[model samples]
Structures are given as structure tokens and as C-alpha cells.
Target: MGQEREQRPVGVRRRTLLLGAAAGAGALALGTDALATRAEAAPTFIRGADVSWLPQMEAQGYYWNNSSGVRQDLFTILKGYGVTAVSLRTWVNPSSDPANGHCGIEETARLAQRARDAGMQVLIGFHFGDTWNSVGVQNPPAAWTGMTYSRMLDAMYDYVYHSCNVIKYYGVTPAWVKIGNETNSGICRPIGGVGHPDQMTGLLNAAYDMSKQVFPNTPVLVHLAQPQNLTSIQNFLNAYGGNGGKWDITGLSSYAQGGNVPGVLANMQTIQSSYGKPVMQVEYGGPVGKATQVRNSLRAFTTGLQGFGGLGTFFWEPEGYPSFNGYNSSAWDETSRRPTAALDGFLNV
Candidate 1:
């Protein structure tokens, strides 16, 4: 889901702009290019886009243009901008809501197949809910709502196994698999909340085990937003680690603004060094009007994280334009119906 999601707690709502005070400390210590030369020797760095909105957008009469004003497929446009991968999110028995629905396994599988056909690596994100799931909310799927804790573990395993098999049946084996989306407070709440770390870890381990069962070679990620908040992340990592939470990659959502990219990258590097897990910026973007700023930030993140031996950076719902879903952090231009310069940041990294 896009960052414009609703029903956030009072203090946890997504912040669009970086506070001046917040941008001064670590950023000054680690400039954007501090690690640029080191990143030159890193392995294949993925610059991806979350086109979960692509099918719906196309159905609603939306298309994209190349830099020369020539109409072309969205994938072609993204490729021209140096995108090497695509991330798709899936829900469990999703509703028919136009903007916020219909990412069920079948739909996601179709998208994965298309991404594979385009020669881009695929990263599958499982929300494990019937609708949007984020740090703000993580309601269990309708079918698993009243299940007992033990029963919920079974359901989680079954769901992951079934979903993975179904997706693979569509002829797309994802390069990376995200167990959940922005699962900071924990997944499925109440039962999976941090208050009951063991329960949450139980569910997470089930998902991780099932994911490995299907895609043994794929890296599984545990995601959280707001990488700059050291206290929050350290607490979650402690709770997760204390309870034996399993993950191959530590995925993050970086919406860093002002000059906080350095601090954010520092925090990510810290996570990697401390946890022995590679990191990736799984979600990021900014308003289309801030195209140049967003481009620079993206470049910094991609290059900086690459230097840190991180996996990748993906723009969340970059295909989303105004009126499509009430989201504004898109990489596409509204009036021109073409990609903004924000995506150009992915190049030459």
C-alpha cells in the first residue's frame, strides 16, 4: 500500500517532510557520497518499482509516455529509466474496492508472470490480510479472524504454503519474498502484537519456514518502516531476536526527507552490521512536484545502500497518480502521463 494510508495512531502517522533538527546529526557525519566509491564494487543492485497499481490503473484508461512523448508500455518506460526489478503485493481474499483492493494471489501471480516476461526480477510481498496492512493496522484475513492462537499458526503456515505454490504455478519464482508489509508493531495485532512477542514470533517463524519450503533459494525479508528511529527499530529487533524471529533480509521503508538520507542509511548500515543480515529499502517515493529532490534522494539511497552491501530500493506505488488512490508520492507525471525525473535517479548508480 501507499504511504497515504489512514487510521494511524496519533504519533505514528507517516511524516512527509524531514524536520530540520532531525536532519542535522548523522547526515552531517555521513554525506550522500561518503560511500559512493565503495559501492562501485557491489553486486547487482536492484532499482525497482512497486507497480501493484498497474493492472487497475490500465483498466481505468491510464497509460504512460516515453521521454520523447511516444506512448509505450509502463514496463518499457520503467526499463528506460533503469528499473531492474518489480515488487508486487498480495492480499488474502481481497475485496473489490477499486483503489485499495484486488491483489489476490491470482492477480499477483499474473503480475509476477508479466514482470518475469519483462526480464525483471520479482519481489513478492504478502500482506496476509484481506485488505491494506501496515504499521497502522494488521487485521487478520476474514477467514482467520476468530481462530485460536494455535489455529492461527496453522492457518498462517497453510496460507503461506498455498500462496507460494500458487504463485509458482504461474511460472514466476520470486527473487525475494517479504513475509509481511511494514510489520513494525507486529502482524495480525492482538495475537501477533509486540505485547505477545512469542505469539508474534510464532506466526513469523511459520511464515518464514513455509516460505523456505517453497522457495528455498529466495531471500525472505522482515519489513518495518521508519529506519531513522533507532529506538523503535532496536526495540523491535530485540523483541524479534529474543523470541527467535527468523529472516534472511532486513527490509525497510525509507521516506527520508530534507538531508536525512545519510542518517537513514547509517541506521540501515548499523542494522546490517549488528544483525548480520543484509538490508534493502523496500518502499520509497516523494510527491511528483518534488521530482528533482526525489531523484537526488533516490540516487543517494540506492548508491549508499549498495555501498553498505544492502539489497535494493523500490519506489512504492510509483505508478499511482492523483485521483487514482489519493496517494501523491508517485514517480509518474499527472499532466504529461509520463515518468518523472525521479526515476532517473536509478541510473548511473
Candidate 2:
């Protein structure tokens, strides 16, 4: 799922670390120094794209071309355009509805492997739903329905831990892990809904704890959409962290269009300053066909982040063409089947 406007949207690792003793030993050995080295060597700014739809697109015979007019793999085209990372979304027991299908842990792990093979870092986004999970809806996975709150907590922990272990089995350790997608109203409704901050934070902390247990080095992020709405973000964080919630980074979904880039960036700065945590634009893009405006907006947003405590920005579904989904914020040119100049915003940032 790769849609802008709070709609459809869009890792692996060490061997011998799966078992009980070995995992503990590996965790002990993977201390602060190893993690520090990775953090230090990473690029200062992350230029990423959420190509969660790549597999389905390719399965349906979609192809892409590089700037030189030569057909190539999507990953190759993205790399050629300065995409340093890829974001893949995963669901639990998802349907098989083409555009809304797949993305189970197995599929996601395979995709993460593909990203790793392409030499790009990975960010695994857990939707915790069978379909779309966003600000408007937070339905629990089918399997988790009708369970008691205690059982739900157990289920969440097991899901996250199992998912992390599966990704590790693919030999890909993600650079970042997102607990839930667009949890502006909280995740896994009723039991863990926004109105119940205690339950909400319980679910978040469970996911965070399990994520850290598996990949202690990777930063666990808590995501909320529409950062320009400062009050909403501040309230969510206040309720979350204020109620003992845990998060390593503050992830935001900023679909800044045109002149709003500066305001969005300022809000992001305020978030970082307010919480003393690094902020990442985990999702952003412009309307289709507005390559010039999109490029300028991205340039301004990323440039501003480079000067502040910002970690990265990911354009949602740059590979999506007009005929793909109903989505229209993609940066690909339908006729040329190549990226528009809009992607140049990531260059040198």
C-alpha cells in the first residue's frame, strides 16, 4: 500500500543468533561499540523511498527505465537517483487482493533481503493490521480480534518478537523499526485506542521492548502523521511519553506541499527540541506531475533537516505510475517510465 494523504502507504542479520544461548551471547557481544560504529559510519542524511508496492508491481509486469533510457531493476533505478534506503511495510495475515495483498512477515523479509542485496538500509514498518492502518483506522489483526486486553498484549509481544527473528533469519538487521503506521489516534483499537492512553502506551511499550530485545542497536520509532498539526503531535507525545511510553526516535509523516515546507520543518524542529529526540520524516511526497514544485519542496525540507536534529525523509511510492494504484503523488514519469527531476532533491543531502 503506497498512497499519500494519510491513506494507503507503504530488514535481516547475524547467523547462529536464533537460539536461546546463542541469541543471548550475540546480544552480549553486540555492545555499544559495534552499534556506535554503525551509527557513526551511516550517512548523515537518509534519502529513502517506500517501495512496498515493488513486488506486486513487478508481478503485474511493470518495468522502469533509468535516466539514460535503459530498462533496469527498480532498485537500480532508485539507487541511481540517490535513494540510500528503502522502507517496506508488513502486515499480519493480509489478504491477497493485489494492491492490498501480501506484505506478511515472509514477504517483507524477502523484500528486506532484496533491499540488502541492493546495498540499501532497511526500515521495517509494522502495520499490525490485515489491511490499511492509519490515523483513520486502527483495526486489530483478524487473529487478535475478541481477545482480552492481557491476551492482546501477549499477542503483540509475540508478533513483534517473531517478526524481528524472522527478519534476522533473512540476514538483514534493519536500521530502523517502526512500531505502527500513522498511529495519530493510537494502535489496535478499543483495547489500545487513543482514548485509553494506558492501554495505548502498553501496546507501544510492548512493541518497543520486543524490538529492542531483538535488535538492541536499531532505533525503535513511534510514528504519527501530519506533523504540521503541532497540537496533535504534541498531545500524542505528551500522552504517550507522559504515561511511561518508550521510543528511541520520533517519526513524523510530513506531506509538505509547496510553500508549507518551512512551516513543516519548523514544527519538526520544535518536536526534536521539545522531546530531545531525533526526528525523521518517515513519509512525504508531492502531487503527481508537479515535479518542479515537489523537487523544490523536498530540497527545502531535506536541507532544513540537514541543519537540525533530523535523521531522514522517505518519499512514498516514487515508483508508482498513474496506472498502478489510484495514488497520484508518485515521482515517476508515466511516459518515460523513469524518475522525474523531483528525486534530485535527495542528491548530496
Candidate 3:
């Protein structure tokens, strides 16, 4: 099991210390007066991997694929890599886009089972689309295309219920639940997008409401697309806040060079200071070749957020298998011998 990533021993006491090993504590040593400031306990969190590779593309380059089963081996590898969480995505249905079966419920369930069997947390991702989806593109799954808004809500609830029920049955409890993938535009349809400032809160409320019903204690995460639109991001949350559409966490997707990392961190500071919640850059990475640089590039973001009250971050797919290469060359090719240095930042090996 010894590799670049180190497996945290089981039965060892869990540490409550926040950012115990944060990168730059050197400069703080000289500033004795810094002690007087409010020492808000840093929230402890898990650094995790999303395992979003297409199942059939084993040749692609996800590091998780081994002989027995990619799902099982992926869990072991995550631990080996010092990651404590596994994110599973739930799509209303499947698509033939790549392998079509890549990260659908079928694969997620399998991965969840293995993760729990291996003692890891699961973060469930629900993409309300038939094909691939994200904040930038959230068209409803084809199955619900003609359905009205009311019907859509019903479908949403049913999907939520089904997801929770299925995962629970697998004996894999999710530590965090993302109601929808980056919801910057809105969920399901363009109508769901927050066009007018007034409907912003209402739309987010209705969406967040779905999670509250089934998984009351589970923290719900609201994610925005891209890092540059900080002002709009704050405004959207404020609107959501009006409807009591409170989420336990605030997340942003900052792709490589999507925006200035410092600007992104500043926006997160506002989220922490004004909104008062743990922040995370939910899905982030660079182009295929730039994965190595991502680790170094992202360091500033984490250091800037030090003591500002931010939760851990997740690099989109660190365990992807190159053998299971995506249809396009843009993704990390898991078929490669090992993950690129982008993953090394999280592994800290």
C-alpha cells in the first residue's frame, strides 16, 4: 500500500485540530500580538477525490483501475493518497456520450460500497441532466424535458429520495450532499436559472428544500461556476439567503486560469466573513498537461485562505484511469503510470 499517498491508520483517534499541517505557519511565529485576535476554531475537514472517470475507458489514465474492480481499488488508492473522502455523482439517467456508464448511479453505487467498506466518507453529486452537466450547462434530463415546473419539482424530489434511498441501502452514508452540480445558472432548465434578482432566493430555496426533507442533518453545498464572478456570486447567495435557502457550505468551481486565484480567495473571504459558512473550491483542476502545475498554482489559494475559515478542497478526478481515457484528450488520462503532480498537491506526498 505504500506509495506517494499515505494511508491514515484506522482506529487512530481523529484529530480535531484545524489545519494542523497548514503550509505557512513560519511567518506567524514572529508575531506574538497575533494571539489576541479572535481565535475562531478552524473547522476540520477531509481532502477528497471525486473519481469521475468513465468506467469503460479503463485505458484513459485514472489511477484507480486495478484487476479486481476499479471501484474497490480506487478506495484503497484514495487512502494510500491520504484522501479521506470519495464523491459519488447521481445522474437521473445515463448517456452514450463516452461509455455512458462512466459515473452513472451504477458506478457511483459500486464506488460508494467500496468506499464504505474501506472506511471513507462519501459526497453525493446529483447532476440533474441526462447528458454531462455543470453550472454552465444544466438542461433537464431528457426524461423530464416536457414536464412542467411543478412536475419538474416532483421529479426532483423523487430523484433526491431515490438517491438517498439507494445510497443508504448500499450502507454508504453521505457526509455531504450537493443538491445539484454547480447551480450558477439554475437547476434542471433555463427557467430554473436565476434571471431576476428577486427569483434567486426562491429558486435556490426550492432546490435546497429537496435535500432538507430527506437528509436533514446532512450539510447541503451550493456551488457556483467559474471564479471570476465574485460579485454576482455574493448577490446570488444573498437572494438565496432571503428565502431562508441556507446551505451548510458555499462552493465555487475555479478551473485553471478561470480567474485570478487571489480574487477567488477574496470572494471566499467575503463568504466566510459575511455569509458565515465554511468555504470550498469544490471542483478545480487545469488542462490535461497543466495538472502538475495545478498543485503549485493552487497553493496560494489555500495559503491566502489560512485562518480565514475555509474547508478543504477537492481536485476533480485525481484517480482517473488513463486506460479508461475519455472520448476527448482534455481529461486526465488515467492510463498513465500514476496521477500527475496536480494530484500530488492533495496527496502532499
Better of 1 and 3 by TM-score: 1
TM-score list, all predictions: 0.87, 0.88, 0.75
Cα lDDT for residue 277, candidate 3: 66
Q: After superposition, how far is residue 152 of candidate 2 from its true place, in Å?
A: 0.5
Instruction: List, in order, the clash count of every candidate structure.
Output: 0, 7, 34
What Cα-based lDDT does every candidate model obtain? 0.82, 0.83, 0.60
> Candidate order by lDDT, highest to lowest?
2, 1, 3
Give the per-residue lDDT digits (tens) of candidate 3, residues 210-277: 45444555667787776577666766677666655656677777764524777777767877678766
- The alpha-carbon lDDT assigned to residue 17 of candidate 1 equals 14
Q: For candidate 2, lDDT tens digit of each residue in 166-274?
A: 8988899999999999897888998888889999998888787678777888887889988889988888899898887877678899888787888889999999888
Compared to the true structure, candidate 3 yields what TM-score? 0.75
Highest-lDDT candidate: 2
Q: After superposing candidate 1, which stretches have Cα over 4 Å from the reference?
A: 1-42
- Most accurate candidate by TM-score: 2
Ranking by TM-score: 2, 1, 3
